[model samples]
Structure formats: structure tokens, C-alpha cells
Target: MLAALPVAVLLFDDEGLAYANPEARRVVELDATAASSPPHVEAPAVVDAVNRARRTGQAIDCELERDGRQWQVSASPTACGQVGVVITDLTEVRRTDTIRRDFVLNASHELKTPVASIQALADSLRLATERDPARAASMLESLEREAARMSQLVRDLLDLVRLEERTGEEEPAEADLAELVRTQTTRVAQAAAEQGMDLRVDVPDVARVAGSPGDVRIVVANLVDNAVAYNRHGGTVTARVRRAGDEVVLEVSDTGIGISPEDQQRVFERFYRVDPHRSRRAGGTGLGLALVRHAVRRLSGELQLDSTLGQGTTLTVRLPPAPTSVAAPAQPPPP
Candidate 1:
């Protein structure tokens, strides 16, 4: 029945309102008895759409905001000199569209920076080749760096898309948390050493988790890389994994520049940098923390950050432990 339909529907003719479903009445907050007379709805946008449909003998659609809600109002003319109106709630859909638009704009802006730098450097190099050999070599180095940065950015964006697609739909397998942490720490230890920072890693002897090994490896690598990359020279970077009751915890701490309370809240956002220039100088793509956060989420994990702006920052991650049948008894890893 039209009256029982979920969508708001109204039928009107040259005389007045011929019929209005219950939903239509509720949407515009009109009384059922008012159906005999044309409602005095003062929304010019919807009214104009209906009038346009009647005058042109064609369908018209418009979106409008009223009473703190967004709506899509459509008017379709009928053969018998009548118009049928349909209103759909567009609040959530519009919000999603806005977010998507913003993301694309931000990503474009981010991509543009390195590309512009590369182009400028290339032009300079071309001119320097005929004028100054030293200048040309310097320009070539700069161009290489910009190209690498752009490559990293594209890779991280793709990784983010894949991770987002897997959120809440992960298929986990039995993985050794201890081995993952230990191996990742080894991979980044050289970088930390080169920066004159200490890399200390501690893992349990045989802590097992249920997660995609590749995804979990990525999470460990990103966090450790961020710790070393953001840390100050002669500082300390520590990574550890331990069992906390039913949960497994992975923590990465850095004795480098800490994040302010304000920036801490947004650190997980894609392409967010506390110090854009400094992060860029450190060869960071600004997507590391975002990737880490999303990957952890896919594994059903919680991440926490603790920091004092001038002291250091620590990121703590907790994940649901593998089933008892899969996990081995926990013990501290070798020193």
C-alpha cells in the first residue's frame, strides 16, 4: 500500500494534494487531514522543483538542506496533469561524498608537491648541463630525492587503500609475534645506529598471534621505522612485545621529539605531519602512522600514544591473542 511504503511519497494535481503517504506526512510533519488542501510547505526549493515539473511536463530533482537535515526532493509529472513527489534522506550519503572529495583533494595536493619539485629540479639540471657541471650534478641529486619521495608516497597511498578495504574483514593465521618483532627490529637496527640512536628490542620466547603474517609484519616495520626516523640523534628507540592476560601487546618508544597534545590526536590521520618540513627532511611519507593504525585495526587491535612535547613519544599496541589451541605459553625472549 502507498500509505505503508517506507519512502515518503506525495501525489498532487492542479486542484491540491490528492494523496500523501504516512511517511510523507511524517517527513514534512503535516497532519493527515491536511491532505485535502495543498500543504503550506514554505520550502522554496522543493516547491520550485514541483512547479517546474508541472510546467515543463518533465521530472525535476533537487537537493536541499532544511531543519538540520539534507534531502533529495524529486518531482515527476504524470500524464493526467498531476505530479508525484519523492523525498529521500541524503544526509549520510552527502557526508560520505564530502569526505571522499576531501581525501582526493588532499592526496592530489600531496602528490603535487614532489612532482613540482622534480620538474623544477629537472629544468635546472638541464640548464646547468650547458653552463655549470657542479650545479648540474647537485640538481640531479635533488631530482633523484624528489622522485624517490614521490614513489614512496604513491606506494603508501596504495597500501592505505588495500588496508582500508580489509578492515573488519581480515582472515588471520597463526603467526609468531616474537619472531615478527625480533626480525623487524633487526631490519631497522642499522638505520637507528646510523642516526646514533640505540635500538633495544625485547620479545617473548614464543608468543603466537592469529593474524595475517604479512600485515602484522608491516605493522611492526612501520612502527619501528617511525621510531627511528622521528628520533633525535643519540636518543633511544625501544620495541617490546609481551602478553597481557588475554591480549598481546607491542610497544615502540622513542626518545626523540615528542608530539604535542593537539597533534597527537591527529597523528593517525593520513598524510598528517606534526612538522611537515622536518618529517619531509627525515624522508617520511607521512603515511606511516596512518598505515600502522589501520593495519592494527584489521588485526583487531588497539593503539595508544603517550608523550610530552619536549621529551619523547611511545606507541603501545594491544591485540587479541590467538586461541589457546594455537598460541604457545609465553616467555621472555633472549636478551
Candidate 2:
């Protein structure tokens, strides 16, 4: 019965190591020859736990790290003067806890900045309304900007959460990649113009992909938005879409202050900013790339980034092409 247990289990008698289940043998690399040896030789931490349980006449639960993995060791004193030890792997659980803690901390820090600004601005606006009407008008604008920033932040957070929670159980409908690129690019063209950046789009008449339209929109909009937001004055931002064999490819390139080699590795991390001051000034929530990454993954796509410091940057995404059977019929020639 003990041998059938899934978790690693070891039985130690007064003499020495008495029995070890298959799991225990596999986990600790124990063999028949080692059965007669003391348990400490195999796992010192397990031995210590067993000793503590035997001494106290109760079960002892402890966590330990071994071979770069987290493990939970539970030792119980059997009724017949033997000790039973169970070892369970906890690496994934511990990793998840760490990620959760970090996310909460980062989110709180991101939110606190805007909340504090709004409070301060409100107070100043009140004072200026009575003393200086002109200044009060400017304060009102600033207040509105801050409020909008906070609103955008909240919406992005919700979108990211939704994308992460998706289980890929629902079948995705076909989306027009070319149309998505054109619409997203057009939406950001005014912003590009205001910055004196030339915007361009190159796409086939019909490029279709199998994915959620919302997910694809997020991916396209964020890419275009980032290109416009981080570009240099009079620079060029180009978006291109093409069908490559089994994949639909979208590429957004920008002539901006490119990312350094070191920063490229973490560009997709939530709330991470390569240039925090510039990001805030551009009304960015620092979640654009993170959202793009998640949305692309949800569509079973690949994202690539190439940047040269002081030169330029380009981002590429490849998604599964929609099956020919479901491809949108080519539109009738402009009547």
C-alpha cells in the first residue's frame, strides 16, 4: 500500500532505513543497496525532520531547498516506533507566490503615483479658483489629464487580466489582418502628425488570420501607439502586414530613440519602462508592450523585437493564417 503512494515516502526503523516507496527511491536516487544505510546519507534535511518528529512524538512539517528545487518534507512518528517521511515538490507553488507578491507591489506603486497627483491637483485647483482664475483653468486641465491617465491605467490592467485568464478553449474566428493594421494606424496618424512624424502603412488587400478580433486589435493598436508615442520629431513610423505561407505577419517599425541591449530583455514585463520620464510625459501607462505580448500569445502568435540604440526599432508579430475554407471572400472590385 505504501509503495503505491504517489508522493515520495520513506520508512525508517530503529535499526536504520527500512523501506522507501518507488517515488522515494526515484526522488532521492535510493536503491536496494542503500536501504540498509542511514537516511542522512540520502537526504540530511529529511533525516533531521524525521529525528525531530520522533523526538517530539508528533508530526513535523518543514520546507527545504535541495538541488535548486523547493520541497515540503513532512515526518510523522508511526505507532510502531518507525518514522514515515513524505516529500512533496513545492517549486511551482513557491514561484507562483513570488510572482503574485511582485505583481501586487508593482501595481500599487504604479497606482499610487497618479492618485497622489490627482489629490494634490484638486487641492491646488480649489485654491487657484478663488485667488487666480487663469491659473485655475490650467490646473483644471492638468487635473483632467491626470484623471484620464488613471482611467487608461485601469482599463489596461483589466484588459491584461482578461487576456491572462483566457484558457484558449473557445475557437477563434477569422480576423482581417490588413484591415486591423489600417484602422489602428489611422487612429494614431493624428498623434504622429502632431509630433511631426510621418506615418506609413503597407498591406495586402486581404490578409486574414485565425484569432480573436479583440486580441488582434490590442496587439495592433498598442504597437502603433508605441511607435507614435516614442518617436523622434520628423521621424518615420511604418506599419506593414503580409501573408507569409501559413502565417500572417505584422511589422511596426519606428525611427525613435532605440532601446539599449540590456533593456530589450525586459521590455515586455508589466509596468516596466525603458524611459519612465518620457513614458509618463507621453501619457503612457507602461503596460502597452505587456498587453501586446499577452494578446499575441493568446492568438498563438510569435513576437520579435529588434532595436539599435540611437538608431531605430522594429517589432514583428506572426500569427496563424486562417484556413482557406473560412477566409473572407475577396471584396468585389470598387463598383
Candidate 3:
């Protein structure tokens, strides 16, 4: 019965290890002859828990880290004058908890800035309207901008949630990657032009991929938007799509203030921004790249980033090609 348990179980007497189940043998080194030599548990914490449980004749629980993994060890006195031990892995659980905590803190911080600005702007606008009529217009404009920023943040948050919860229940369809690049690029071209930046698009006749059109559009739009948003005045933003063997490749490159090596590693993380001030000024929600990352992963695609601090940054995405027999329909330009 002990051998059938899923968790690691061991029976140890005062002399040493009397029995180790298959699960326990997998977790710790067992001697060839259990009757002669004691088994070795590399983790000191586990050994201590067993010794303490035997000495006190009570159950003792402890946690330990071994071989870069987290383990929860429980040792208890058995009826046969031996200590019974159980070990369960807790690495994924602890890591998930840490991620959940960080995500909440970051989301709260991101929302707080816009909320506070909206509150202050409303107060100033009221004062301006009453006593400083000349400045009232500008205050109203500022208030609108803050409201828009918050709205965009909420929308992006929803998008992130949807992407994370995607179940792939719907059949994948063939989406024209080339068309998505062109359409998303055009949508952001005016913004690029307003910033005195040149926008360019290079796409093949048809670069099709097997994925949901919505997911592909999210990936393309965010990349193009980021290129335009982070670029310097008079910089160039290029959106390109091509067929690469069995994959469809989309690359967005920008001559902008590039990300540092350290920042690049974490840019896809939710609410992470290399230039927080600039990001806010550009009406960024700081969730665009995160949306792109999630959408790409949902489609079983690969994403890569290359950048230099002052020169430029380029993001590349490769997705599986659609079946040869599938036909991609024309997608209307985004409004």
C-alpha cells in the first residue's frame, strides 16, 4: 500500500532507513542494502524533520529547497517505532503565488497614476472654469487625455485576460499575415506621421498562417503601435511580412530609443515599460507588448526581440503556415 502512494514515503528507525517506497527512492538516494546502510537525504531540512518527529513522537512539517526545486516534507511517528516521511513538490505552486502577487501590485500601480491624474484634473478644471476661464479649455483637454488613458488601460487589461483564458475550442482558420501587417500598419501610419516619423510596410502577396484572425491582428497591431509610440521624431518604423519555409514571419523594426539588454528580457511582462514617462506621454497603457506576447503564444508562435540602447529595436514573430488547401478571405481594414 505504501508503494502505491503518489508522494514520496519512507520509513526510518533509530538505526536508519528501514523502508523506502518507489516514490521515496526517486526523491532520495537509497542504499543497495537497506538492512545494512541508511539512505541519504541530501536536504538537511528533511533529515532534521525526520529526526525531530522521531524524538517528539509527533508529526513535523518542513520545507526545503533541493536541486533548484522546492519541496514540502512531512515527517511523523509511525506505530512501528519508525518515522514515516512524505515529500511533495511545491516549486510550481510557490512560483505561481509569487507571479500572482507581483501582477496585482503592478496592475494597481499602473492604474493608480491615471486615476490620480483624472481626479486632480477634474478639480483643476472646475477651478479654471470658475475663475480662470482662459485656462479652462486646456484643463478640459488634459482631463480628456487622462480619461482616454485609463480607458485604454482597461481595454488592454480585458484583452490580456481574454488571451490568457483562450481555450482553443474554435477551429483555427487561415489568416492572411501579409494583409494583417498592411492593415495594422496603415492604422498607425497617421500617428507615425504626426510624430514626424516615416512609416513603411513590405508584405508579400499572401503570407498566410493557421490561427485566429483576431489573435493575428492583436499581434500585428501591438507591434506596429509600439514601433510608432516609442520612436523618435523623424525616425523610421517598418512593418514587414514574408513566408519563411513552413512559417509566416512578421517583423516590426523601429529607429527609436532602444531597450536596454536587461529591459528586453522583461519587456513582454505585463505593465513593464522601459521609459515610464515617455510611455505615459504617448498614451501607452504599458500592456501592448504583453498582449502581443500572449497572443503569439496562444497561436503556437515564436517571438524574438533585438535591440541596441540608442540605435533601434526589432521584434520578429514566426507562426505556423496554414494548410495549402485553406483559402484566406479578405479582411476589412481596421477602423
Candidate 4:
């Protein structure tokens, strides 16, 4: 009967190991002798099961975890009043459960916030239209703006989902970090045209890095874009890239309205905005900093931010220099 059981079983008296099956030893890495020995921790379930089974002479079970290992354990008493116990490992099962719960919670909060805002704006517009024509017009305008904001929020959320799914150990190789800056700046330069903001780049031609070009672009370009977008019309956005010891430093400084000490801590959180009305009106998606954080981690880099409200902001990214194996090519040998 014990041979037919799926679990690892151990039988013993108050003294020690009277019996131990193969499964118990395999699951807990315990020998038959060690099985019946007093367990390090008190297992009430095992003690209760042993006492009850001794009276009925029946089999029973329990569950427990030790040293980060999950196990289902059972205890029973034999006809002679001795105890029988079993343990089965469950580490993988518990890990799967935790991952599932976190995914569900994060997804729910992200999808719900924008949806609630949109619904409230629509309801307000409807009430205003019924009571006052002039107020209705104002409400409609406000509703339109909120609807656009919600639309952008939804788009950014979708982008985040896609990025999260795609994040893995893989990254780009032998990427000319400087070129990426040149290309993206050229494209975003037009957007800053109306602001009269000056976009300057100071990257050497020989400089190159080893990482995903796309990720590095996301980290640096996003910061520069944000700095330029948020700056005053006549502000300056200066981008500098250089090697400092074993790290590469890429910085973007702006003369825009800076962040307050309060909003600084939360700037990296999804959907957080320093100035909700202004950010929304400017078509800010609120996912930029979150994206920056993700990209920085992927590149094995650090991001530093400094800002003073009413003055400006500066963002710096420091990445480990390309590995020795991937450093810029050696110069040609002399004749």
C-alpha cells in the first residue's frame, strides 16, 4: 500500500526513523535516518495528524515550507501507534502564483485610471449642455481635451505593454551611440522649431558603444525630447556625450520650467505628471520617464536628474564603457 502512494513517506515513533520512503528523501534532500528525526521547526499539522491517525489508524496529510522550498507534508499513525509522514516540493508552483498576481494587479490599475477619467469628463459635458448653453460650450471643449488626453494615455499604455513583453536579456551590439543621437535629434529637431530652442550635440566621431542602439536611443533621445518639449520658447537644450573613466556620460540640459522637490520622486511613475493640466494640454503621455527607467536598466546604466523649478533641468545617463572585447577598433599599425 505504501509503495503505491505517490508522496514520499516516513514512519517513526517518538524516538526516531522507523521507516522512510524514497520520495521524502528526494523532495527534501533528506536521508531515511534524518526523516524521522525531530524537524527543526515545529509542525503542528504533522503532530495533530499523527495523534488523530493513531486513534483511527488512518492516513492523513499537511503542507509546509522550509529554506525557500515549498512542500506538501502529511502525517499518519500506524496500527502500532507509530507516526507516518510525507513531503512533496512545491517551489515552482508558488513562484508561478506570485507572478500571476503581480501581472493582474499592475495591468488592472494601468487600464482603469484613464478609463475612469474619460467617463467622468463625458458625464460632466452632458450635464452642462442641459443647464446652460454657454457653459455647455466650455464643457464640450474641456471634454474634447480630456478625450485627447485619454487617447494619448491609452496609446502610451499600449506602448508600455509591448515594451514589457519584449524586455529580455537580448540587446543590440557595436552600436554607434553617437549616430543614434544624430539621427533622432534630426527628426525631433523640427518639433522644437517653434519654441526657438537650440539643440546642440557634442559627441566625438570616434566614440561608439556596445548595446542596443534602439534602447540607448530611447534613453537619451527621450530625455532630450522631454527637456526640449517642456522648456520655455527661448530655452536651450544641450546634449553632450563623452567618455569618463570606465563609463560613458550622456547628458541633456534644459532651460525649461523645472520640477519641484515633491514631483521629483514620482516623475518615474507611470501616468504621474508634475502639472496635470499643463502636461495634458501639451499632449504629454506621462510614460516617458517610466520608459527611460526601463531602458536604463536594460543598458546597465544609471540615470541622474537635477532640476530647480522656474530655472531648468538636466538629465544625465552613465553607462559602463564598452567591454574590452568590444572597444573602438585599434588604429592601423605604423609602417
Q: For residue 63, what is the lDDT in candidate 1? A: 83
Flag regions of model 1 displaced more than 4 Å. Answer: 1-7, 13-44, 67-69, 80-82, 115-144, 166-172, 194-196, 232-234, 306-308, 325-335
Best by lDDT: 2
TM accuracy, model 4: 0.54
Of 2 and 3, the candidate ranking higher by lDDT: 2
Tell me the tens digit of each residue's lDDT in model 4 across 57-158: 777766776677877767766667687777666788888798667646654765566567768867876787787667877766766776776676676566
Q: Which pairs of residues collide in candidate 1?
A: none
lDDT of 1 by residue, 44-143 (tens): 7767888899989899999868788888999999888889999898888888898788779888988898999998988888889988987887788889
* Rank by TM-score (best first): 2, 3, 1, 4
Where does candidate 4 clash, by residue pair? 8-24, 61-74, 62-73, 172-212
**Candidate 2 Cα lDDT to native:** 0.87
TM-score of 3: 0.88
Candidate 2 lDDT over 128-170, as tens digits, reads 8889888987888888998999999999999999999988488
Better of 2 and 4 by lDDT: 2
Model 3, position 13: C-alpha lDDT score? 84
User: What ranges in model 2 sit over 4 Å off?
Assistant: 1-6, 29-40, 325-335
Give RMSD to native, each candidate: 4.1, 3.3, 3.8, 8.4
Pairs that collide in candidate 3 are: none
Number of the candidate with higher TM-score, 2 or 4 = 2
